[model samples]
Target chain A: MIQVEHLTKKFGRIVAVDDISFRIKKGEIIGFLGPNGAGKSTTMNILTGCISASEGKALINGIDILEEPAKVKKMIGYLPENPPLYGEMTAKEFLHTVCDLKNIPKPVRKDEINRVMKRVGIVDVSGRLIRNLSKGYKQRVGLAQAMIGKPPIMILDEPTVGLDPGQIIGIRNLINDLGRDHTVILSSHILSEVQAVCERVMIIAKGKIIASDTPENLSQHLFGSNRLFVSVAAETAAVEKTVKSIPDIIEYQIEEGEEIGAVSVKMKAAENTDIRKAVFSAFAAANQPLLMMRPIDMSLEEIFLDLTSAEVEL
Target chain B: MIAVYKKELKSYFYTPGAYIFMGAFLLIAGLLFSLQNVFAGDSNYAGFLSSLIFIFLLVVPILTMKLFTEEKRQKTDILLLSSPVSIIGIVLGKYLAAVTVFAATLLITMLYPLFLSFHGRMDWAQIWGTYIGFFFLGSAFIAIGTFLSEVAESQTSAAILTFCGLLASWIIDYIISFVPTSSMAGAIFILILAGAAIAVFQSKAQDWRISAAAAVIAIAAVCILYIVTPDMLYGLISKFIAWFSLTSRFQRFSMGILKLDAVIYYLSFSAFFLYVTGSRIENRRWS
Candidate 1:
């Protein structure tokens, strides 16, 4: 649904998005993972036609944004980090205005507004002025505004940021439901949210797309899949001796156990090694009960933090 | 475009901006109307409109202060900018909405002349000609106010800047009276104008090559003109100021001399300012 080619955006001397390129297919839910100032919002703004890129071009379904912005904008809905809302307007009025902006037929505008309000669950507060609405309601209203015309693509920047945990779940579910028909590109620092809702993740740092892959593949690729965590009810010294004796053991850490006289340990085996059997037998031979043994995969948060901080070759 | 117009118009009414502008305008107009025409038994309705011309100077900024600034500060411009609507549509929509409020207020004030008609004879052509002039003049001011609002970052600063801009227009004729009429002074002033233009272009484009090219071209054009016909530079500053002076041109309409050029002047002035406003916004995305 979107193709960005060598896109770069410069604000005076500062490069906000530099030489970044990516493509998103139809019906794909992609998460943009980055820390603050990671060119995520800049990329979203360029795709939505809110701002023009300083160099290169972006295509929305083969439509050039700078050449035919109005036509392209009609196909994409954007929810900026700060919801673009008028405090004087009610939620219904705001949505109606958005429908007009999107050029929906007058006959269908009423139904479209109502359906979107229902979808975003803002129908009940449609009559209340936006100034009186709470942050969660306001966010929903912003979402409703973007969904009013049923654009094929939705670019939501931190869509679930200010919502309570329950509300976050609700919106996450909404985005998942929306993924059936809409191409979703959402940017957030919340790694778990992205992991839960997105099929693919693009990690951006310092204005570059440093990595792009499925979350699981990223973990497997970045850190080889042989790392494991094991806890045993035994003396720390004995656990260390057994860990040293275990073959294919690359690196390991001995950690304090929750129970007295037991030790918790984490270890990384050699490439492609299934250290589980070796770890089990090693602990059994020492007469130490193996309380837990599981391979430890990298979570999205660690991958995001580590990738943004240092260079990682794919 | 209609959506933007309706929203902006409704906002003016919902906020106290339209009411305050119209209230102050009509109150002063009413006081002036009753005192001059009713009490003094004057019959010149055009005189009343001409005398009330000062109302637009104070009230136009109130009508236009938040037109673009509010959308920007609230970040609601993202909706408008990201939508399918064109920048011209948004600018014209907001401009027309502000004009509509001023027109509606002017229509109410028309009842004053109708009241005078009940008592005695009135020069209907002169009355309406002045009304047309006042409408165009107020529209021109609204356009300036709109441009200033776009330049300012907040509503308060927009209003203050617009007020100062309009007030400067009110005193432009006096300011021009003191400008030097010598060719040297005019050439110097033109050079300064070119320098300012180059400065603005340099800051926006951030490209020394383009700005330097523009500066070279500007200087060359001025030098050629100076060498070709130096007389053309004499009193050039006053002519430039006079060409841009909205109120001085409005004097022709107030005199009941409906010159085609003056009407076109008022319209073109408003169009020019509005075009600047549109460019200011359109350039925002690129920059």
Candidate 2:
């Protein structure tokens, strides 16, 4: 529902968002993955019509944002890095003001505010001043602010930055629920959370988009080898020799195990190769017992580190 | 626009701003009312209202210190700017809310004339006329305060800067009498204004060619004006300062003569600053 062309943003001499373009489909939960200051928030700001791009254009539902900002902004619910809230007002009062700004009809404004408060689980504390609310509740209030008016697209910047574990899970679930109807474009530096919720992920680094793909596909396409970590109850040299003798094994490292008389080995096998059976037979023939063997896939964290650090070109 | 106005007006009451502003204004007005009209036997109620012009210089900054600057500090401007509302809507909404408070307080001070009504014959025309002039003048001051607050980073700085700005405008009328009235001084002043305009244009357009062309056009226009009427150039420096003296126009309404041109001038003054404030905020997205 959104398309950007050669979008660039300059804050004086520094180029905050370089010439980068991308499109987001309706109802797609796209995760903006990037490290700190990687133009994630800047891109979101431009997309929501909160800020203008120095070059090129942004279109929302085929309407140029610069030409029709009021219309485009109406279709977006933006939660900036810090939620724009009034501390002096209660959560309910704040939502009422937001409904006013969003032009929710008075007949349904109360019901709409109730729905959002319930969705974000802030209904109980709705009567309390926002300044007195905990950070997690305030964050939910921010989320509730964005979820009001039922805009087609919801852009949240770092939705889970300051929260306890349970609150994190709660917000993640809330976002997942929002994903059913709203096209959620949430930015976060946390890879695991993005992988858990996003159908597609875009990795940005240093004001440029380095990669974009599904979480599983990104990890698979960037990882060149499968690895195995095995702990054997045998002499270190024997474990090393047997692991080296396994077929399709490119390289292996053997280290003294934490347990006595055991050797731990980390071996790299060729891509798509399964060497567990061969290694089992080799150790069995050498009169050494296999204690533990597990295939290790490169996690998304490693993929994120690799992508952000320019380890591979996507 | 109404939504922003309602919310902004409501916020003033929700916080201590509205009461404090009203309280300070009434305290001073009451003290002046009793001291001059009641005790000093000064039957001129319009004169009492006239002397209260200095009240704006002291309290207007307090009224508008947090209008936009507080929004920036608390980051609530994101909500206002990112909404469907136009920049003009936000600007006008806040401006009108402040003007409403100012008008409301000015109405409360109407009790002073009512007191005079019981004790002496009153020139209702002159009283209301002066009230009208005072309202417009205060509205103009509030517009400047709103613009100052928008440009400043914090409420304290906005308040201080606004105070300085209003004080300067207040003092400009007095400052004009001491200025050189020579035609050469007028020419120099006009040229300096043109130069500053070109500098401002250059920064905004980022094109020296267009700015240079504008500078040339300004200089040419000034020269043409000088040649057409050399007499007008004499004392032009003081006249130029007088043009911005908001109180000088109010002095007429205080004399019970409602000049339409002065009304338009005051309204235009407020409108001009309000327009600049709107554009500055809109330009922030690009900056």
Candidate 3:
């Protein structure tokens, strides 16, 4: 339930958020993928009403941010990159303060705070000062703060940036769970996290949205070559020559191994080609035993790099 | 707004800022009351109250330094700004919180006056009137400190800038004496002030025509005023400086003469600063 139209933010001479636009439907889990300084945070700030845009406008449920920020802000729960925490305050106190600022009814404030704390798994540390908690716990508290108001939209910027692997997974699961009812727009440089958690991905670079699609489609669209890694009992030169003879084999690299008579060859085939059959037959005709052959699916990391780097021919 | 106000008030006590501000203020008031009234055996509580203005130079910063600077440094402002709370709510909450601490501390020092009432004759009406003026004056200073804190980037800078700002206001009466009283100097000063306003407008709107027209209008107004009312420009610079001299207005309170204009002036002064602080915060979101 968000609409952004040609939003731009400028800091003095530098345009932090270039002419960018996007929309999120209700209950959609959207991932904002971009390298550092990609204007992801700027866009999030604009959407959350934390900051204003130099041009264009953002609407939360058709409430223009510039015209009626307080109303729109009530619908958004923003967890900034730094968490916006008061380290001196205990978790419970912090959440209570957030509830108050959100104008939650006094009757339900305590229950709402507890519910969010339980959701983010921070109930145990509610009595501890936020400064005494670890980074992961602090992040959970930040999440708890955002979820306290039960707002329909949650904008989290790098929610799991410094967390350990287990904590990251926990947060990802929490986000996925939250996505069932609330619209989520999360930004992270961690490609796999976004790929695993987000339903749709928007890849931004230099303040521009270069690509937007489903995570699977983005990976598949950016990956133009099918790679097949094969370990074969054959001479390196002969294996390379045979693989190069395949009709659609675009490139091949052979790695000589310590094993006296084996070679590992990585072969690249044209997009959508089944090169395994051709390679197997080619090796079979030469009496070279194929030890292993497997197609290498491009990882999200590679696709993210390919999408964000300037050299990518969008 | 109420929520923010409550939370802000609670935070003052939760942190060391309120304690430090109150403790330092009471200590100074105690020392001053003893020295000016008890040691001297003088029954004039107004003199002791008048000397307490110096305490604001130190403790006002403590009360207000963290109002906005700490929020910015901690990034907690994002939560406040992104919430349903208006900028005015946030500013008022912070201002009232600081004022509350100052008021609470001032209340503790009321014991000094009670002790005086026990031992000797006391002018209760004058004492109460002076207190009202002092409260308003302190609120105005805290507002100025709040605005200074918002303009400064770091807490240390905010504290230091607020101290300097309060110091300037403290010495404003003296500084006014050195200002040029000639009509020519006043006209030139007015022109410079008008130019600064036009420059601010140009920076914001980035429209040369509008700023140019504004500049022409300002200069023409100044020229017409100079030609029509030559006597109005005499001592104009001193009058302008005196108008901003917060302490000069505060003197009426210490004299136990609570003038309506002075009370309104102190209130409007505070409102003006609070408005500036709110605008600065809103401008930050756009910039």
Best by DockQ: 3
How well does candidate 1 reproduce the true complex, by DockQ?
Answer: 0.83
Q: In angstroms, how far off is B263's CA in candidate 3?
A: 1.1
lDDT of 2 by residue, A76-166 (tens): 9999989888888999999999999989999999899999998999989999999899999999999999888999999999999999999
| Per-model TM against the reference | 0.94, 0.95, 0.95
> What is the TM-score ranking, best to worst?
3, 2, 1
List per-candidate RMSD values in Å: 2.6, 2.3, 2.1
Ranking by lDDT: 1, 2, 3
RMSD value for candidate 2: 2.3
Candidate 2 runs further than 4 Å off: A246-251, A311-314, B201-228
Worst 10 residues of 2 chain A by lDDT: A305-314
iRMSD computed for candidate 3? 1.0
Evaluated at residue B248, the lDDT of candidate 2 is 87
lDDT per residue for candidate 3 within B1-287, as digits (tens), equals: 88778887887888999989988888878888888899999999987888888886778999899889988888899989889899999999999988888888888888899998889999987898889988999999999999999999998999999999889989989998888899889899999999998889888789999989988898898899899997899999899888888888878887789899999999999999999999999888878
Backbone clashes in model 2, listed as residue pairs: none
Question: Residue A304: error of model 1 in Å?
Answer: 1.0
